[model samples]
Target: MAISDVDLASLLCSKICHDLLSPVGAINNGLELLEGETDPVMRDRCMDLLADSARASADKLKYFRLAFGAAGGFGEEVDPAEARQLIETLIDDSGKITLGWALQNEALPKKAIKILLNLTLIAKEALVRGGSLDVGAEKGDLGIEVVVRAEGAKIALDDAIRSALDGTIASADLSARTAAAWMTRELAVENGGDLRISSPSATELLLGAIVTA
Candidate 1:
């Protein structure tokens, strides 16, 4: 169930815009408030709000550029440190979620980098109640293995996303919410890789992908 390239591009753009709407809207609102505020203390508070909103907007753009666009410099491989920084920024405003990154100094191929970033995005969304996300990768005899684990008080995975990642959902049914998951699966398959999801426990969700070099 593959979609036309145009359709895929449109879907991704919609996803990014939707994710950014909140913080961007806040920035606009903050500007309006600042324009009307007269008290010194109130004006300072509005400025703080604007700063936070601007940071969040920038973070979202950085995360999306890696996950949905090309941003890792022109190369066959992307630096793992850059990926870590992108993920950290992505979760900065998503409550008290801690990240555990453990990847070798070696770089990952462009395809693997995309898969990793998309999986990281999905895992971050699953931890609505705020939790720990551990991302690790290693190149082995089998292939490049990427694992993203999420554990929190409430780990809720939407059924649509689960099916999409498992390659059971139809392309026509894919919405912006499940678009990234579908894209992740597609990338894995194109690279002789596979995506898997462990039967999440009461409070844990595991996403794994393997790409053969």
Candidate 2:
């Protein structure tokens, strides 16, 4: 049986929600604990945990909403500063990855921004062993080009993810890789563009998108 693209997209969204529920729920639980605890010291500590978890969960939600959901509301273009801030927050909250940006454009098409964010998430997942990620964009005579590269000690590019990027896997069964790939493809198509993916070695993965100027 085959899955419709809509269903696949829904499944991807579901997976994202599933992954996030834990930490978000923990934040709620911590808040409840803080409410019941009478000790000022213990209450203070619980409050700290609640605050940190809330911020982290919120940051992830913001990034994921833009990356996996709609592309509008920031207008037809996205401010590079906002994008940079969101990326920074995502890395900081995760606490296991580093992100470096070399953005040449001050603003990007909203669809392009979505693609970039999704690709960044995919690169972060690939760098499970702690590594550095480089994300940059350049403008050419043809259009805008965005590039994401991940390098680490042990990079594992999931086959399902590759399949999604290659348009061989249905979106419904999208794991991390597949969701990113699917989002990338959708953004490319929306912008009259295309995506290119390359994994030259076990520790390196590259993803790029080219869209009209």
Candidate 3:
């Protein structure tokens, strides 16, 4: 099955909106609390929550603009250090997810970067019980290879998401799994790459992509 660019853009936009709702909702809740509270300490807590939520929302927008939006600045090639920094910022702002990076090359194609970022997000989602994620990218004679691994005591990946990544599910529903899978598939196709996944058991999951040079 073929996916149109319009469909891809819509999927990406839907994904961004879905991710932003949490922090934005928190900010709104904090505002509501402030309106109801008279205590100075409670007001202060609300202010803190508002600030945190605002910053997190801003960070995600900035990252998503470059990753998914129409920003012409990111050329065909991306700086590895910059990419790593962006990913780190996302992980830090999102909270509770640890990321480890191992890049053999200093740069990679833009499509590969986007795919890797989406994969990282998926891996983070799988670690609901809190786990570690390992990300690595290397350039080979064939092309670029990226790997994302999540290991935890309780890993629960939605079946819809798995189906999307496997290209067996459509994106009409646009759940977290479907959105991530759609984004990953779009990037892979744009760069002539392929996404592969392995779920050996309930507690472990692995995702990888390879793009032809």
Candidate 4:
């Protein structure tokens, strides 16, 4: 099933907007509190909250621009460092999820980068109780291999998202939550590759992609 470009655009927009809502709402809330708070200590606290919310909002926007928008200049390949930075910024907010980034490649095809970003997004979401997130990419006989592993006290991956990542989602039933995963799966398929997810238990998750060069 081919998704029209316009529909794809809409889905990507929805995903970005949805992810941003919380941080953006926080910024709004902080502003509202600041407007009425006259106490010295509370004003300082509100400022701190505003700063954190603003930073989070900026980080999310940066992640989404690379993951869903036309970024990385005019190049067909993107720097691995850039992707690492984006993911790092995202994890910085949680202050609980530790990131172990091991990228051996200097760069990868943009489509592969997109797949990596989306997979990272999914893995990050699965770490419900904060965990270790290990993300790496390497080249092998199988092609460009992107692997992400998340282990925590609690992990929760939606079945719908898993289905979307594995190209098992019914096209008519796709929703905002599965949009990024579905897009990742399609990109891998187009590149002669596929996506896989393994969650042996509630405490662990592993996402992998093998995209042919």
Against the hidden reference, what TM-scores do the models get? Answer: 0.96, 0.87, 0.87, 0.93
Across 149-173, the per-residue lDDT of candidate 2 in tens digits comes to: 9998988887788777766775355
Among all windows of ten consecutive residues in candidate 1, which has the lowest summed lDDT?
Answer: 67-76
The lDDT, on a scale of 0 to 1, for candidate 3 is: 0.79
lDDT against the true structure, per candidate, is 0.89, 0.79, 0.79, 0.87
Residues 1-213, model 1: lDDT tens digits: 868778878889999999999999999999999999999999999999999999999988988888878774654788899899889888887658999988998988878888999998888888989999999999988899999999999988888999989999975579888888999998899889899998957699999999996
C-alpha displacement of 150 in model 4, angstroms?
Answer: 1.1
Off by over 4 Å in 2: 1-5, 71-75, 170-177
Q: What's the true lDDT of residue 29 in model 4?
A: 95
List of clashing residue pairs for candidate 4: none
Candidate 2's displacement at residue 173, Å, is 4.1
Candidate 4, residues 100-194: lDDT per residue as tens digits?
A: 98896577988778888989989998898899999999888988999999999998888888888877788776877888898888888888988
For residues 1-213, could you state the per-residue lDDT of candidate 3 as single tens digits? 566677767777777888899999999999999999999999999999999999889888867776676444655677777667777887775476777889865767777777787788788778887767889999888688989998888788887888778777754655533765766775786677788889656788899998875
For the record, the alpha-carbon RMSD of candidate 3 to the native fold, in angstroms, is 2.4
Q: Can you give the lDDT of residue 83 in candidate 1? A: 90
lDDT, residue 49, candidate 2:
88
